[model samples]
Target: MESTLQIMPVQRTSRNFGEYAEEAVIIEEPIIKQKRPLFIEANTIEASLEHLRNDCIIPVFAKDNEATLSHVAFIEVVQDAT
Candidate 1:
C-alpha cells in the first residue's frame, strides 16, 4: 500500500524575554502531498535522510526491523543543528 507524505513549511515565531518570557510558536503551512512507501531498506539516519533527499519521503521504519518500533501514532523528525 502507498502512504501519503505531507510536506509543510515550519515557521517559528519570535521569542520575547522579559518578566514573563513567551515561548516561540511554531506554525506549519501545508505545501504538498507526495505518495511514498510506508517502509524501506535504510540502515542509518543518513540512509533515511538520503531517501528523503532523493525520494522526498522518510521511511517510517527499516524493512529489517532490527529494533523495537515506537508505539506512538505520530511521526517526528529530529535533526541536529550543529
Candidate 2:
C-alpha cells in the first residue's frame, strides 16, 4: 500500500526586507486512502506519493460499496506567524 500524503514546507514573508521565511510543514494527506508506517518504511514519502498518484486505487465507503471515486484533493499549507 502507498499513501498519498505530501508534507510541504510553508513559505511566508518576513516582516523585514526581501528575505523569505520557511516555517512548519503542512501535510496534504489523501482523504480516500491511508497507509501504515511499514509502507512508509518500504518507500520514502515522496516515492509513496508518486506511486499513489499512479497505481493506488481509492476505496469508496459511499454508494454502499458499489462505487469508487477518483479522489484528488489538496489542502493549503500554512504555519504560525511566529
lDDT values, one for every candidate: 0.52, 0.58
Off by over 4 Å in 1: 19-82
Model 2, residue 42: displacement in angstroms? 10
> Which pairs of residues clash in candidate 1, taking residues 3 or more apart in a chain or in different chains?
none
TM-score of 2: 0.23
Determine which window of 10 residues in candidate 2 has minimal summed lDDT: 73-82
Per-model TM-score versus the true fold: 0.19, 0.23
User: Over the full model, what C-alpha lDDT does candidate 2 score relative to the true structure?
Assistant: 0.58
How far residue 35's Cα lies from its native spot in candidate 1, in Å, is 75
Query: Highest TM-score, which number?
Result: 2
Decoy 1 TM-score against native: 0.19
